[model samples]
Target: MSIRSYLLFSIYRFEYWMQKINKKGAAYMLALQDVTKKYGNQVALDEVNINIKEGEIVGLVGPNGSGKTTLMKILNGLIVNYEGEVVRNESIGALIESPKYFEHKSGLYNLKYFNDLFGTKQDVGKLLEQLNMDHYKKKSVKKYSMGMKQRLGIALALTAQPEYLILDEPTNGMDPSGVREVLRYLRRIAERNNIGMLISSHILSDIESLCDKVYLIHNGKIKKEHRPLVGFAVEDKDIGKIEHILLDMQDASITDNGIVKVPKSESKKVSQLFDEHGIEIKQIEEKSVSLEEMYFDMVEEDYK
Candidate 1:
């Protein structure tokens, strides 16, 4: 190859590697380490460390008084008295607690007001369209139903098109249809804009479908976390039969598929053993774990 062509190739390779490295570094949108928050004698958060990566939609799940709100407040930069380190890589949009709305102003006005806060000039018309709330834009927020108010709040928070978005107790009072509409847009935000969203909600189904992963917090700490599971059912009645089929396998991750996963090297041995047991493999497939099951696992693991 000519020196000119060689140099061009080298430059292209260098640029590609640099971009990959930059993207990897940009993955983490937020990180909290050894964080502690206190209110006189009451500790709201205790030595917490959590990291939120870019392009990740994470749902915070916890019962009331479990410190879910406190963690979200710290994330929104609303609580500055924390004892540990909190880092956010970019600008954020947040609506925490009950979103403060202009009772007298129309929904469009609220959007415009928040847009001005971030010094953005995006058209309210377009935002309303995206949120599927164009019909209610001109109506007074005070007249809006609880669901409508939450939708407007979501629209307002997203007006800035922030890199980091945090919503605490989102969908507090939305009707089923309203909640579905909101989740649809939130999913679009994650998929299309690649925004990292930290949402705390009591709606388990919404969290299951909307989030890339879930974070369970308890007693001011992150008790557990997991990605969703996809799978068929496995009953305890079948466990005994399956165990007899493969008692040789040590600490295998067992599920309904009859000793589902073993170490890669031992997979063949386990499979052959199960096959010999005359186990009618009805369906041996990868399965997604249900959100309810995941929640149970989170609680169980935390307590154990």
Candidate 2:
């Protein structure tokens, strides 16, 4: 193994033991207990509570200027003047806001630079390959496209092989295809490295697809939490029967469009129920809650 790989492995093992010994069997990798922040007189975050376990991906969803950036900044220690408590049990890698790089330097050089600065000893070549940017690794960052720069930003964040990640609008400047690829890479890396990740994004589809749990923030307060839901679109027969059967599950409901919704956790059970009852499912909808439905619901509740 390379020096960087060896060092990272050693650190990972050491931290693993430390976490076990210190937490007394708590599996939480990071916990925010009533964390709040303000900018002068303006409250940016209001008593936000969140938790992310190792290997779990959590999403912070909100409109622009709705405290998402503030919360991420606090988690990354870029902004520390806050209220309540943040319990972090792991090292973090982050890509917050626009990823800034030495415009004239090669992407590889930037990675090597950070590695040297942090003594991380990362395999810069391998990292770029993983990000599908190896071909451009030697190219100047100034000549790279927005999406490429975004990928480089992510690569920079991972150079430390951190136990946790904080990504703010990680898909910014990427085309749809680029966005999908980045999300796939992120999910794969999180699972492979057992990294706890907290991602903040205004794009509901991205959050819905990537996050296991989601927190909705509005006006600086966490308005609600949800496990991303999946809508099973039943057709060609007995939709009502399937919907009726699913209703027995908590929060299972049918939309006006005849889509039966259930938690992603229950998707297999849903299929089994259908198979047993001889119900035919025409299609499975996306796994995340409908953005319009969820946003409208939150807006109404906020006004109430």
Best by lDDT: 2
Q: What is the per-residue lDDT of model 1 for residues 3-92, given as tens digits with 9 covering 90 to 100? A: 346536645654443332222243366867788888898887888877776767888888788888888777665665667766676667
Instruction: Name the weakest run of 10 consecutive residues (lDDT summed) in model 1.
Output: 17-26
| Deviation (Å) of 233 in candidate 2 | 14
| Clashing residue pairs in candidate 1 (N, C-alpha, C atoms within 3 angstroms) | 229-288, 229-289, 230-287, 230-288, 230-289, 231-287, 231-288
Model 2 lDDT per residue over 1-304, tens place: 6545654764565444343223334547687678888788899888998888887889888777889888887666666567776677668899988766777889999899888867887898999998889899999999998788889988999999899999888888888888899899888987788888999776788887788778888889888887867777766446567667766787677777777777764666788987787777878865564655776688678678
TM-score of 2: 0.74
- Residue 76 local lDDT, model 2: 68
Q: Rate the local accuracy (lDDT) of all candidates.
A: 0.71, 0.79
At residue 245, candidate 2 shows an lDDT of 73
lDDT of 2 at 241: 70
